[model samples]
Every structure is written in C-alpha cells, then in structure tokens.
Target: MPSPAAPPPPVVTPFTGQFGLAYPIICAPMFLVSSASLVIRAGNAGGMGAFPALNYRPLERIREAIRQIREESAAPFAINIIMQKSNRDRYRHLELALEEEIPLIITSLGHPGEAIRLAHQGKCRVYCDVVGLDHARKVADLGADGLVAVSYGAGGHAGTLTPFALIPLLARHFPLPVVAAGGIVDGAGLAAALCLGASAAYMGTRFIASCEAEVTSTYKAAVVAAGCHDIVNTDRVDGYPGNFIRTPALDALGLEPSLVERILSGSRTARRSLARIRATRVLFGAGSSRATYKTVFSAGQCAGLIDDIPSVQQIIEETIRHYHAIKGTLP
Candidate 1:
C-alpha cells in the first residue's frame, strides 16, 4: 500500500466518537503479544489498543501499567478481562479497572453481566466479544455498550461465522455499535467492514507483526511469511480452538490433546488448572519445554495480508490512507 499524499478523510463513527478515537480501529488484545507500549502507541496513533489483564501477573502490574499509560499518553486504551469461571482473578482485574476509572473494558469467554453493571457505575463502557448472534443478543440485553464481532479467521478463540455474516446480523438485531474482528488487516478490509455495518475494525494479526509487538523475532517472521493456509486451528494449546501458525514448534505439540488430557479438559475446574499450567510454562519457564511453549503464538488468517513490520502509527496512518483512497472510488 502507498502512503497518502494528502490528509486522510475523517472516518469517525459512533464507536470512534464514543471511545475518543480518530480512527475506527481497535488493536485487539492478545494474551502475550499486547504490552503497555503497544497499547500506548496504538492509542496515541488515534486507534484504541488493548491488552489482556492476564498479561500482567501479580495483579499489581495491571494497575501500574494502566497508570503508566495514563501518565505517558491521553489516548483511549482498554483492558481485557476474560470473564470465564476459570479466571479466578477476573473479579479483581475488573475491580482494579473500575477503581482506576479505565474508559473501556473488553470482556470475553463468559457472561459480562457484572462487568457491565460495575463498569457503567464507574462511568466506563463494556464491550463484549461475541462470535455469533446468540452471544451478541445476550450481551446487548445485558446492557453492553458495544459488541466486538469476533468472526472466523480471528487469531484467538474465534467464532465460526465470517465478518460479512456476523457484523450485519448483530447490527440488524441490536442498536449498539458493532466492531468487526477477524481477517481485517488493511484499509480495504476496514472499508469493507464499515460497509458491512461495522462501526470500527477490531484488528489483531496485523499488529502482531508491528514493531511494537513484544513477541520473539522468529514469531514475527513466521507471521510475516505465513499465508491463510499456514494458519490452522488447534485445541491442544489450551483446550480451546484458536488459530495459530503451523510452525515446527506448533507441530511438536501434536494434533490434539491425549485421551486423559481431553477428559480432564472437559471439566471446568480441570480446564482452569490446565490453563494456569500453560500460562506458567509460557510466562516463566526454563528448559526446552519452555522454549517450545513460547513458540505457540496465536495469529489470524489475516497474517497473509501483513508483509512488513511497521510501527503502530505507520500501520494506522497507512490503513487510514488506504481506507480513504478506497472510499473515494466507491459508488
């Protein structure tokens, strides 16, 4: 994509206006990839950036990271909280977010009822990540401010529907703003998403290759070199189906969990314990096993669209330029 010769046109929508973003993009939160610097850069660049609360361990780091971003930049940023029963710290994470008066909270994997209530009380907004209309309706009914339609080809645990199908479905059924997530990486994608009734584009895979991402260079290279075919869905990583690049490290993990592993994963409690074990291995580990775990990087099929490692600002600016250029040619 070429750089813009002139200033990009305003692409503001209700989502961007409400979130104080100049661009209709959200750097979707990733488990290990999203960092404070990435969030700050994305926000300062006129797009919202987020990181999972679990990314910072010991809990206090979450507060510190929030404060660090607040001190350094005035851009809007979000903290993701996995509301599943397994995330024992979800309450505390949400508590701290509300206590700090964070602007937005992204909830995933569980009902966001409590999060919505508390966040609204704290004068913040809650956006639930939904893969289908069923979940979208539920969250909307729960008074969620917006919906993040996580369509197929998304990096993490994605839904089965495509953005074309999911985005319109939610927009038609709910009055709230919808942010389309999935295989959106460029201005064409951002333009198409808005045309499909999305207020913003929720991007993850593209940013994984950004200079701000903290992943290993090998992981970044894999993302840059990969195509749609190189991306595969695997449940062995953490007992949930998430798309990942098929690297030698991912191949070594095997195709699926063992029989006993499968049975244990069937239980919520066991799944939680297993997730903690995986988190431990990934975040702080020593030995070859740890090295292998580190390679289990999550990415979307949109990795095929990303060829270069650019700064977060460059990505946003180029995307906005592309979007304007495309919008100009539209009928």
Candidate 2:
C-alpha cells in the first residue's frame, strides 16, 4: 500500500479551520514581550501570533504595527486588550482594532459582552481568558468565540487552579472552543491540552526566549538558567497574582499595597495605571533602570523546558514535529 496514505494527517478542528492556522497554537499576547516581529514570524510559521494593544502608544503606532503584520504575513494574528476598569483605553483600542479589521481579539481581566458585540460587528472573533468555571460561564453566555483557561503556573497574572483541573472543567461546561494556558511550553504540553478536550494551547513564557521576542538578553538568559523552583508567585506587581523568577529585587517588594495607598489613589483607573507603571519600571526595565535584567525577571514554571533561544519559525516547526513524533508512539 502507498505508505498507508500517510495516515491522513490529523483532523483539523474548528479552531484551525476557522482561523486558517496550520497548528492549534496561539502565542499569548504578552505585554512588552510579544512584539510585531514575533507576531509576524509566528503567523508565518503556521501558528497564531499576538501582541498586547497597550504595548503601543498614541494608537497610531498600533495601527501601523497591524498594517505591517498584514503586509508581511498572510497568517492570522490577534490583538489583546485588558477589559478591566483599569484599562481606560479599552474601548479606544477596540475601535482601533475594528478599524484595522484585525482577525482576532483576546480579552482579559473583565467581562467580554461589550467586546464580543463590538468584535462581532467588525467580523472578528473574540476569545476571553478565564481563571475558573464561573468566569468561563459568564464569557460563554456573552457569546465569546473561545475561552483561554489561564491555569496555575502561568506567567503574568496567572490563575489559581492547575491545567489538569481547569481545562476539563471548562471543556465539560462550555460549548465553545477552549484554549489551555499556563505551564505549556512544548509539544507535549500541547498534546496534553488536546487530550483534555482543549482545541488549542496558549503559551506566553516559552516565547520570551524566542529570537523574535522584544525581551533583552538578560531576560532570556534568566529564563534559560532557571527551573520550576526558581519561579515565584506574588501579588506585588499590578496588585494581582503573577509569576516571576525569584530575585532579591522581587523579594524586597511588598506582597500587597496598603489599604491607605489604595484609597489615596483618587480613582480606580488612576490607581491601576500607576500600578502598571510601577510594575513596568521595576520589573520590565521600561524606564530608566539599570539593574532590571539581573534583579527582576518575569517567567512561568515552564522555564524548565526552555534550553535555548530559537527563532519563532524553528520553535513552531520543532514543536509540531515533536507533537507528531510523540503521537506516533501512542496507540
């Protein structure tokens, strides 16, 4: 027989078909890390790429970034938006995304009903990131096209439950597609998510080590050098729980801001904005900070899987290859 017809390849799910992606992977829209180059490269490599809308300033820059991605690659990409009250410019970013006619929108930190409505009006798909079943049900009722189960061990404002528990919980209840996030760094993780009934995987920490990522050499080096034990979860940054590599600088930061500090901040929007600025400065080296690289670094438990920094294309291709290789060995 003619090679058994190559086993007919894997069945394409609704996610891959609807988005026209070759693989069921989404490069999480990591703030300050996922840049235009990373997004374009990931898309060209047959997986969906994304970046945070807040990464760009003045709105026009984001428009230009979108234009550049479209001009350079035909693969689908997404823009992430913080939907909470702190993101004062959420609607402004949404309007810009709609104007650009972007392919996908990922909403986090708040309700998705308004976003789902506006995205649908613009013919774009909206996927909300949820930490638990209640959040999943809320987003589903709001007509979210998909749900990203942000489980424990994820980087940058991670959830509380483990993927083993979170993915199936959402899959069992929600009728829409589910994307598994948190601690997913390689093809094996992707395969596990699929086995759990998730249609795709959303990965952020792994991409920080990508050649296309906007992270510095110090950040990349830290991720490569660290292991799961080095990862720490704290609420000091942004007033919410987030994962990061343990360091002296991180240790020195307070676990949570004081109640008086919260009250004196005038408004919720102002407090959130200020918190973000502080976090960026202390952790990401966004402003004048010389010790950012050595003293602070954000990462997930998946750092254990990253051994080398590779190009986006190489990463995606190798991941898919490994997935097939692993699947071939199974009955």
Candidate 3:
C-alpha cells in the first residue's frame, strides 16, 4: 500500500523566517540550565537555542561555548546578558558577544541600549525582556529587534502580568516581534501564545526538564513532581520576584530583605555579589535538606504539563506536532 501523507507543518511566521528556524520557538537562555549542548541540540532541531552569558565563568569560556555551538550546528543561537549595573561582568561579556558576532543577544534586568548598539554594530539582533508595557516601549525606542514578554508564572525573575495581558500590550504598542514567555510548557500553550499575537514562544521552565539541560536528576525530579500551585513567588532570591518550588531552604529564607537590609549589604556591587553567592548556595548547593531534592528549583506554572524528562529534539518535535493538531481543529 502507498504511504500515508505526512502531516502539514506548523504555521511559520516572520519570526521563523528571520531566524531561519522551522518553528517560531526560542529556547530561553536559562542560567545554569541552558548549557552549550542544550543550545546545540535545540538549534539542530530547527529552533533558536540560547544560553545565559553568565553561565560561563572567566568570560572567555562564553566565547568558547559560542564557538562550540557554531561548530556543532549551523543554526542560529542567542546569548543572554543581564543588563543590570550590578552585573560586574556584563560589559566584558558584551564585548565577547560582539567579538564573536553572535546571532542574537537577549538582554534582561535593565535598559539595553549599549548592548543593542554593540549587537547592531555586529549585525546581530537584540531582544529585550520586559514585564510591562512601559518597559516594552522603552526597549522598542532603544532599537531592540524584539521583545520577550516575560509575564506571570515565569520561572526566574518573573513579572506580575499574565502572558495574555502582556503580549497584547506590547504587540499593540511596538511593531517589533513579540515573544511570549512564562507558563508555556506544552504545545497548547505555544499555540495560545501565537493566537495572542506573539510571533514566537520563549520557553524556559519546560526546557529544564529536558535531558540536555545541565541540571541534576534531583532537579528534574522536582520539576516533574511540581504543579502550578506548587510554584511560589518569592523576592528573597535577588530582590526581584522569582518563582521556585517551596522547600525548607526557601522557608528558611524567612522573608524578603527589607530596605534597611538591602542598604546594609553595602554598595550595588557588593549587594549583587552577596546575593549571587547566597542564591548559588540555596538553589544550586545543598540547602533543602528535608525534600527529596536539595536544591532551590525554579519552574513556571506550566510545571503541571511536564510529566517526564525528554530530549530537546523530542520536546520541540512534539510541541510542533501538537501545535499543528490544535490548529487543524480551529475554525
């Protein structure tokens, strides 16, 4: 008998064309989780993969990671840089990103004009993460190529507004492509984001459960076991709101740092450094003694959708397949 016809591909928008990707999906540059191997695999799967610049220490290692990704896959990838003044290595990493001529730069935490300018000079695209309409407008005015609407239920450093609200707000105000983030773990969420006016979906928490992610099996277990309600928003991590699985380590944090405590921590650099150390120990180190996992795991509300650990290729392919299935049923 003749072979049955293959299913039609997911709808391709300008985002897919601009980034040379088969799907309008971008792997979020999640710190610690977004490893070089993960990025390479995502790119090979016809999606734009990304890794946080701070994931590599000594700065030079970032360039090496970028080179490794380039050598492994011809597909485009992105590098994320925290634009806060407290990030002492921000400028150094930016320099390396420009020198390497990275394809995309994802900026978060603060204004990204300098990074945008440098990325533009290297003929690279800049996508800034914004939680609100005001921030979106500012980044657009600063010449950002795109905006990542990091809405409520995101894993780390999340915003208050839901994707439904933030995506439309930014899309209406700016002509740049809008990438929806937060609580997008499966194909249905991806399709919903597109329907809400996002050109692409930027997923982080779901990718954490992928095999290629540089995380412990324990971390993956926590993610797999979690649901939307299990995720908690706490500002004790780094003065910004972040979603994390509530564990003994998190409870021990007591409460958010007071203004006096923040001031007493010293200057901006000192406070940032101290916060980084504390965060590293609590989240990545052994602090959560009571739970099955000992790390402070971060996950989006979409954790409910993550039932098993899968390969990056599997995740992307399944997401696209489900997306098409959902689209076919739509009017």
Give the number of the best model, judged by lDDT: 1
The residue pairs found clashing in candidate 2 are none
Name the better of 1 and 2 by lDDT: 1
Q: For model 3, how does the per-residue alpha-carbon lDDT over 1-331 read when each residue is reduced to its tens digit?
A: 9995453374687688778788887888887788899999988887889998878877778878888998999999899998876577788978888888888889998679999988887778999999998888888888999999999999888999988889988888888889999988778998999988999998888899988888999888888998778898976765567888876677776656668766867787766665565544433343532321234677888887789999888888888888988878988
Which of candidates 2 and 3 is the stronger one according to TM-score? 3
Alpha-carbon error at 267 in model 1, in Å? Answer: 9.5
Q: Sorted on TM-score, highest at the top, how do the candidates line up?
A: 1, 3, 2
Model 2 Cα lDDT, one tens digit per residue, 1-331: 4552122133356789888888888888887788888999988878899998988887899988988898999988999998876677889999988888788899988677888998888788999999999888888888899999999999888999999999999989988889999888777888889999899888888899988888789889888988899998876655567888887677767545678766857788876766666555643346664333335677899998899999887787777777878788877
Q: Which portions of model 2 show Cα errors greater than 4 Å?
A: 1-11, 254-295
lDDT, candidate 3, residue 259?
81
Where model 1 places Cα greater than 4 Å from the true spot, the runs are 1-7, 256-293
lDDT of 1 by residue, 1-69 (tens): 997455455688999889767899898999888999999998888899899998898899998898889
lDDT of 1 at 22: 87
| Per-residue lDDT of 91 in model 1 | 97
